[model samples]
Target: MHRVRPLPNYLVQRYHGWKATGYADNKAWYRRLASDGQHPRAMVIACCDSRVNVISIFGADQGEFFIHRNIANLVPPFQPDGDHHGTSAAVEYAVQVLKVSNLMVLGHSGCGGIQGCIDMCKGHAPELEDKGSFVGRWMDILRPRFESVRDIADDKEQAREMEKQAVVTSLQNLMTFPWIEEKVNAGELTLHGLWNDIGEGSLENYSPESGAFHPV
Candidate 1:
């Protein structure tokens, strides 16, 4: 509490601007949204990268998407050990309570988290190996997938592939949840894995049938 301070001047100004323009323009809609609970149809698991704008990419408005962001958009396997599982809890709420029909894992190119995982797997990031390092332990979820791309000679290419692997791994992990599995099997929920190329402004979708990603 001692370290807490008022919002910065620039942020305060920006908030005023948005409140004046965007909020004013949609005042009625915003009021209605506040009164009625959200009913988003999709839940997007995305990276914490600032450049990857999930809402802008899909042209989504407020209340349309339930987004959960993490280091590499990784979803750990289901383990009900009574631990603080933020991602798992989000998934559970989205599936069992929110009942979102579509669950999407969105990965991006040039992700620092993916690079950290690669570095960690190659033993180049010793700091991440420390027991108390949260990023190190979190990146462990993607550590096993690094072996698949380790043979690639091109560093840039390897990183790109690893980024997509993060999405794939998360999709696989989502299935580990029995509720998610049941919904998918009953044709009540659909899972999607997508990769966004920030520089090119292009998107790719992972096809389970083709076992590869294709341009969207």
Candidate 2:
């Protein structure tokens, strides 16, 4: 039998504290959300890094944004093969069902997944190159973008550029989906790419015209 442990005490205590305070203070809003369902205007694809808080950064309340978190904040190409594609599924739901008007891909500095991709591409992370490594396979989505930044002599600069490239790669892949492309062409949906400097608490918006990320 597979063993499943109970919730840790600290987490339980935290949940109780939030239930008593945050939940109690917003009981009516919670109830309304439960009854009315979510009608968020935007969908955000962000990294699974603990430091990257999509809600706090945007000052968004619960249900205000349909957010999807994944390693490196990646969106793979539109592959309709019979396979489990969590990120793609989320995008389909957000676009087809929820009909969100905006879709944003948010990347962050010092992302472990991005670093892992760097190490893997440089042949430094052998474990990640293993056939059984899920992370390695997932990071492949960003592998093609690594070549664009590889010529940078400074390691830190290369990593930073690669992180921003993650956002760009995802944005490009988002358009590969026929529905997303159709909506974008028809002006029903708009796509955005953003990179956040975690330690500095700064955000940059990607501009297609300038082909670069600028401070937001």
Candidate 3:
């Protein structure tokens, strides 16, 4: 509490406005959600990009989705090395405790994190090559996939291609968890990969059968 400070006036004012309008309009629903705890059916693992709005894009109400965001929306492989693993813990809670039926990895266009991975892999970004960089290590999860699109000469499109590959990698990584794999095998859970084009405001769903992404 000692480390905490009052919120900025702009954010405070916005909160008050939301309380007056949005909150007041849905007082009962909000109260119900609080009293009964969230039972979200889906868990959305999305990129920590300002452009990606997980709620607004789905037109989902509060408590509808248990959402987690990370750099490039990546999920590292299951490593129970006893170190703090925030993303894995969230995935465990969502799959084991919350029992979310659907999990989606949402990747977006022009993702800075994905671009950083590309640069680091190509020996372009010296800063990311440093071992002390947490972002550098995180982006390493996507490093192996970079080879798949290395032939693409266009830098922008190559980054976009790797952006979708991030989603593909995450989907594969989720199954590394024993519990998640068990649930998936039993048909209790489903995994999905998605890519978003921010400029076009379009969403594409990955089709494993066709090995392509199609607009929803």
Candidates sorted by lDDT, descending order?
2, 1, 3
Question: Which 10 consecutive positions of candidate 3 have the poorest summed lDDT?
Answer: 155-164
Clashing pairs in 3: none
Q: Name the weakest run of 10 consecutive residues (lDDT summed) in model 2.
A: 1-10
Which lDDT tens digits does candidate 2 get at residues 1-216? Answer: 479889999999999999999999999999999999999989999999999999999999989899999999999999999899999999999999999999999999988999999999999999999989999999999998888998999988899999999999999999999999999999999999999999999999999999999999
Q: Identify the runs in model 1 with alpha carbons over 4 angstroms from their true place.
A: none
| TM-scores vs. true structure, each candidate | 0.99, 0.98, 0.97
- Which has the better TM-score: candidate 1, or candidate 2? 1
Residue 97 in candidate 1, Cα distance off native in Å: 0.7
Q: Model 3 reaches what TM-score against the true structure? A: 0.97
- Candidate 1 overall Cα lDDT vs. reference? 0.96
Question: Which pairs of residues clash in candidate 1, taking residues 3 or more apart in a chain or in different chains?
Answer: none
